[model samples]
Target chain A: MGKKITIEPVTRVEGHGKVTIHLDNDNNFERSRLHIVEFRGFEKFIQGRPYWEAPVTVQRLCGICPVSHHLAAAKAMDVIVGAGTGDGLTPTGEKMRRLMHYGQVFQSHVLHFFHLASPDLLFGIDGDPAIRNVIGIAKMHKDLAVQAVMMRKYGQEIIKVTAGKKIHGTGAIPGGINKHLSLKEKMSLLDGKDPMNADKMIEWSLGGLEFFKNFHKANKDLIDNFAAFPSKHLSLVRKDGALDLYHGVIRAIDADGKKILNDVDSQDYLEHIAEEVKSWSYMKFPYLRKYGPKDGWYRVGPLSRMNTAEFIPSPLAQKEFEIFKAYTNGKPNHSSMHYHWARLIEILHCAEMMKDLLNDPDLMEGELVTKGTKSYEGVGLLEAPRGTLFHHYRINKDDQITMANLIVSTTNNNMPMNLAVESATKQFISGQDKITEGMLNAVEVSIRAYDPCLSCATHAIGKLPLQVKLYDSKNNLIDKRTKD
Target chain B: MEKKQKILFYGYGNIGRQDDGVGVVFSEQLSKWVEDNNLQNIDFDSNYQLNIEDAENIKNYDIVFFVDASTKESVNNFDISSIEPNSDVSFTMHAVSPGFILNICSEIGEHQPKSFLVQIKGYEWEFQQPLTAKTENNLQKTLIFFKKYLKKLLIEKKIEEIDLKSLLKIKND
Candidate 1:
């Protein structure tokens, strides 16, 4: 028996997960596994509920990104309603849903960058864990911290104004949103009266891009090669191949930036995607259907979305997108850390899109919803802040959900997260003595780059804090550290 | 006359679980009491868990009560103790403890509000289960005790005017 290292309940992102590194007989690194510990059985419990209730009920799965689940479920329900009627959702309703969804994506991305990822970036990853947090950042850089809070608050305000609340807002529905954005709400966001006004958010987003650009330039080695690996990318793109988060056809590109699938209808997701379950962890691995379980694994979320999209439609984001691609030599950037950069770009695009949507007069005055044909089964897809989210539901004629299946972003990136951890452990952890707290944190940093939502991914109970334990060849505990 | 201090009651836990929702229940009752009595300078909020953003939220408050359900057997049905900020920060950004939130506030804000944790004993934690009968009984007992206790703390000008009856009732109840 060789030494083994384990990081239980990886922290800083949503949900609960653990990392275990197995060593060979010679004390060399064998492999590392990221274990998702919490499981909620959302798929099983959601059955028997009315299909119309899914958009609202599923939002409870994740407090951090409830809007994503809500919209995804609403989109799926749209198909069900459209099945009964020949026509789908009205154009007004679709646009309203898009506006609300952009709010969610914007807020979620801002939260990730400012609160979760910035602590590590601003302060060195290997710095003292005690002060390497949002608080630490606030103490050192008051202006940046205040701006970050205001930025996040602006995103939340967008959600609150458009949806209903900052978290778990019941805005989207089967055909469209429950309500349209009132002129008061629209003007509040657009007008500079609010501290976190739209114009300021756009400005901050651009500043954010510049900050990340400078950071990347300063730390090229860490930013470019940290947990870097080749993998297929998946996202949704418009007909013209522009990045579209709310509505678009599925597009997948290989590691070499070669298109594997283009313009696949979200309704046909089942035909192109399949999930493989492992007994070791609660999370299921989803892969491209054509490649089977072995070679079918693909990555999603910010990095994948940026790579798969032809170009960003928003001006500021489009400019940053070019610089983003230049970093990878026009190929898919494999570095896990770059996920942070890609996420910021998406945020910039979302802010710009929000401004565009709010400016449209048709959005303010319209029939928010239309009666759609009721169908037995339907699938809804959207680009969640983390990645693409799919909500599939089967309902009987009574409109009660008979079956529900959700392939969240965290589940899609499970394989890559595990691989990233393994890669990080191999690169950083040399021997038993070298497995310091900082090294353990490095492994966790790689996992955090994906921003896995373990709570939403797992259907189990009990909070699992981050705990790392090391064992000797004889299976004796050598060292133990836990983050409460 | 001195200005009334701003107080915030932050209750956090999964309400779907049987007893884990005690914090939320307490906060709800507290909110009702505050509203009924027309208590000014007091605010109530509850959520699934604490986040980093909450630190800044607590900066303006003069005092904060962090309520949550506790599984520790040694603890009484209802326990209240003053809490201080600590430097142990979590990299996991999803959920944070009240102490951690206070620590963040202390670092970011000009003043750190006096804070306390009110832990209510919980009996069950099953998914989708309602509050267990035992836990419900404990919650009611804790509520009455705090109702009288918080009243004095709010009304009295000095700590010397405080009586230990409201505090002792927890052990007896």
Candidate 2:
């Protein structure tokens, strides 16, 4: 037996995940695996519940991204209720949901960059684990930290108003929305107090982008090549190939930017996608069915979204998008660390979308819902903060959910995460006499780029402090380290 | 009677999970009781979990009670501990601790509220399951004890004048 090292419950990510590396007798790397230890039974839990309860019931899957689940479930139920597909909702209903979604993406991406990713960027990976966190950012960069808190608060306030409450919001219904944006709410969000309004959000968003661009300019090597690898990318793009997070057709591109899965209706996702189950991890690896499981594994989330979209619709983001595109010369970017750069662009885009939505008159007055002939089966797909989220449902005659299937964003990126860990281990941990904190963090940094929500993927609750254990050639425990 | 100090009871938990909802339920039940009895200078809020924004929300109150459900073996029925600003960060930043929120509040806000964490013991945590019978009993006892504690707190001129130990003694009844 050779040495085996395990990093259990990766820190800083939203949920619990573990990484294991096998080394040959000479301490050279043999293999690595990213394991999701938490098990999810949300599909089973939703089976017997009334179909109408899905939006609220699914929020229990994750406290961090409940709005994503809420909206996705409602979109799925919309089909069962005979609301046409993505374009079927009333103008007010669609716009309201889009505002809620943009709020979710803005806050979620902000949380990922500021709270989880910035600490690593500010303090070197090998920096003292105790001080390498958001608190440390607060101590050293007070202005940045305060800006993050207020920006996050602003996004949450948007959710509160649009979703109708903070937790388990019931604003998005089956066919449409339950309420329109009132004048008071509209004015408050559009031109509220100094830092709480839309303009401030857009301003801070630009600032965040500038911060990342400066960091990238300084740390080109680490940002571009740390865990870089070539792989396929996947996401939903608008009919004209614009980046549309709320609704779109599924599209995918190979490493060389060749279209493998052309624009396909979201309802036909099963025809083009399939999930493979591995015994080592609780999460499933989703792949393009045309290539089969072996060669079909692809990357998703911020980096992939950047690779897949042809152009950004918003003006500011489009300008940034062009710069991002010119970097790769219209080729797909496979760098894992660049996910942060792509995510910041998305934040700016979301902020711009929110401003436009807040100013639209339809939000203040319009039909709330549109109904049509009932359909028993429906599929809902949206660009969640992490990646593409698929919600499929089948309802019985009694209106109870008889079958439910959910392919959360984290699951979609499982294979890419594993590949990232493998790349990091080969580069940073191979043939090492001692595994330094920096080496261990190098492996973690690759995984963090995707911002995987293990709790959402596994539908469970637990802490995510990291623990690493080393085993010698005889499979004996040789050393251990823990960060709580 | 002295001027009433603004107090807030902020509860946080996943209500869809069995027993984990005790904290949120505690807030909802107590808010109704306060309204029915015409209690003044009290406010309530609940969420799936606490986050950075809460620091700003709690900073406005003169005093705050953060309630949650705990599964620690050491906790029998419940436990109440005063929280102070500490920067020890949680491994997962998905949700933050009361101490962390307090630290952030002190860092950014104009006023720092006196804060306490109230933990109600919970048993199960399955999805969509209602609060277990044993957990319900514990919640009832905690609610009864809290009503008296608040009444005493509102009447007293100083927060220090209220004896937490004496109020805890009422838990047996």
| Shift of residue A199 alpha carbon in model 1, Å | 1.9
Give Cα-based local distance difference scores for all models: 0.80, 0.89
After superposing candidate 1, which stretches have Cα over 4 Å from the reference? A83-87, A192-194, A360-364, A430-433, A472-484, B1-5, B25-29, B74-77, B127-173
B1-173 per-residue lDDT for model 2 (tens digits) = 23435888998999999888889999999999999989888899999888987887887778888999999998888888778888767767656899998988887774688788889999999885678988888888788888987787667745544334554565555
Q: Count the backbone clashes (under 3 Å) in each candidate.
A: 19, 0
Q: For residues B7-78, could you state the per-residue lDDT of candidate 1 as single tens digits? A: 788888777566877888788888999899987778887766676667777887777888999998887777
Give the clashing pairs for model 2: none
**What tens digits encode model 1's per-residue C-alpha lDDT throughout A174-268?**
87777777889888888756455778888888888888989988999888888989999998888789998887889999999999987798888
Q: Write the per-residue lDDT of candidate 2 for residues A1-484, one digit (tens) a residue.
A: 4788999888789888899999988789999999999988999989988899999899999999999999999999889889988799999999999999999999999999998989899998788877888878877888898889888988998999899999889999999999999889988888998888999999999999999999999999999998899999999999999999999999999999999999999999999999999998899988889899999988888889999999999999999999999999989999999999999999999999999999999998989988988888989899999999999999999889999999999999999899999999999989988889889988999999999999899888877567899998778998999877
RMSD of 1: 3.4
TM-score of 2: 0.96
TM-score for chain A of every candidate model? 0.96, 0.99
Q: Is the docking of candidate 2 incorrect, acceptable, medium or high quality?
A: medium
How does residue A440 of candidate 2 score in lDDT? Answer: 92
Candidate 1 C-alpha error for residue A77, in Å: 1.6
